[model samples]
Target: MSDFVARRPIWSLVILVAVALLLWLVFSVWTPGMEAAFGRKRVFLSALFNGITLGALYFLVASGFTLIFGLMRNVNLAHGSLYLFGGYLGYSIGELTGSWLVALLVAFVVVGLVGVLMQVFLFRWMEGQDLRQTLVTIGLSIIFADLLLWSYGGDTFQVTTPDWLSGPVTLPLAVALRSNGEAVLMTYPLVRIAILVGAIVLGVLMWLALNRTRVGMLVRAGVDDRDMLSATGVRVQLVFVMVFAFGAGLAGLAGVVGGTFQSLQPGEDTRILLSSLVVVIVGGMGSIPGAAVGALIVGLAEQFGSVYMPTYAVMLTFVIMVVVLAIRPQGLAARR
Candidate 1:
């Protein structure tokens, strides 16, 4: 399979081009139907913006998941729990202190501490035991969920954003109205744009860390061959523990960002976790760039699907996963 991919790399390029053309055709033919369904041509711009914002959030969450899995091969099912917990904690702190920035900082630190504790108390003992790791993390997730439900109740909550980020920003670009009226300028929540910018910055930083730093070299080496890394006298366990904590911190930060824009509820943990799983599977298990691409695809599919095929929107992600897997089981950027 690797040889085939290497020899005929253009095949992947061809597939991508075909997919783009198909999407263009579908959207072109269906634009009128969409405007009719939504009663506005602005829905196109709205959906596109929403998709990009949502994809940014997904990338933040999935990047952490991929990092942990790529380095330690640990399926941290409790990751979503950490996300919800972080949001709830942030909410509590923000309400108490009346400071969103404080809440965000505290949430990241607290969740990172929890991650470190979980690694020390639970995962460290079960090294190389995939089944045990999975079961334990699942159990922990259930426990965290129940605890959160009991304490926070099932009601949805949204974190308060800073004053500077509360309003919408109008874009310089505008779209023509379906009624042949004057073009309307699009506006989006400033917070959403912040999230997108944050994701991009985080992606670049992560890329640099992985490619330009010694720690990143160790991480990549560990992902490729843990036994060899350990044999080289690197403190593999310590490195993994730090990686897990960092990943968990990222998840916690994403939770707070997401909760600020969307509502946080009882099932968000599972939903985000599932979304992360889909992203990593489609993007390539450990590839940062792959995660970003997968997140964008999933985000766009979700937004467009909800508008055009509301009845089947939920199934769209699964369909994408299936299609991607059929074409490239190892994912879009799996290591060769």
Candidate 2:
């Protein structure tokens, strides 16, 4: 970042100015004129928070995608199906057991095991065959989608939010001033905040595990040259299988999160799969940090566009993707 700022000082300055303006808009008390021009402060604030939380959700889904497609070079296009399956499975588990946390674990484990089967029986045989992987996974995704539709029907389902995280939590940020001269603080759902926090923590842990551990070294080596790693008496295939499982498990976990905050029905798999692909492309393929940056940018664009320019809202996400592709086809944070 420092090097880029030095090389592109003008662009850096523009970014700083934009951030400052955004901060002022968020923190300052809007006068009547400002409110008239920009709508209510509460609306803006809500959009901003919603964007951030949504980005967090995207990160959960895309991180897994980057791991499988980017790192492992396994084109699991059936990923969205995995996410939808996980959500449905989690919902069923949650219903039967009445435990949200347990549902989370079960989804992760079950979906991860499914990933294991894919890696062992399918992807492993077609190693380095991108076109084949793509076709096979597409077929699998269709089959999975049809199966899920058959079981769940066309009805939408939302996972029950746990009791502790169900209510709205008051934030210190003031959205408006009350008539009595008191500030009207912002209030947001606790679950969203928790999801954001969890994403950040998981991201950090993943970075550490991938960069700081011996297993990480093996994984990186395997990605770079599995033949060499295997020749070194390492179980490179096993490592890859684990990575695939973990990545797929993350999709399952994200499914539960999505089901909790949003409704699950047919076609959501496509939406989320596209979102993950866009995020990975924008953030940089095979880059964890890139996924984070892309997710945030996409999330903010979606929410703010919807709130401010409803007609062009859906187009805004694609516009951002196009701009990113034009400026940095490799992505914002390409893997080193």
In order, what lDDT does every prediction score?
A: 0.88, 0.92
Estimate, for each residue in 1-336, the C-alpha lDDT of model 2 and write its tens digit: 899899889999999999999999988999999999989999999899999999999999999999787656776789999999999999999999999999999999999999999999998898878899889999999999999999999999999999988999999888889899999899999999999999999999999998999998887787677788889999878998999999999999999999999989989999899999889988988788989999999899899999999999879989989998998899988845
Q: Which candidate is the best by TM-score?
A: 2
List clashing residue pairs in candidate 2.
none
**TM-score of model 2 vs. true structure:** 0.96
Question: TM-scores of all models?
Answer: 0.89, 0.96
Superposed by TM-score, candidate 2 places the C-alpha of residue 131 at a distance from the truth, in angstroms, of: 0.6
Lowest summed lDDT over 10 consecutive residues: which window, candidate 2? 67-76
Best by lDDT: 2
Q: Report the C-alpha lDDT of model 1 over 205-322, residue by residue, as the tens digit.
A: 9999999999999999999999999999999989988898889988888889989999899999999999999999999998889899999989988998998789999799999999
Native-vs-model 2 lDDT? Answer: 0.92
Separately for all candidates shown, the number of backbone clashes (residues 3 or more apart, or on different chains) is: 0, 0
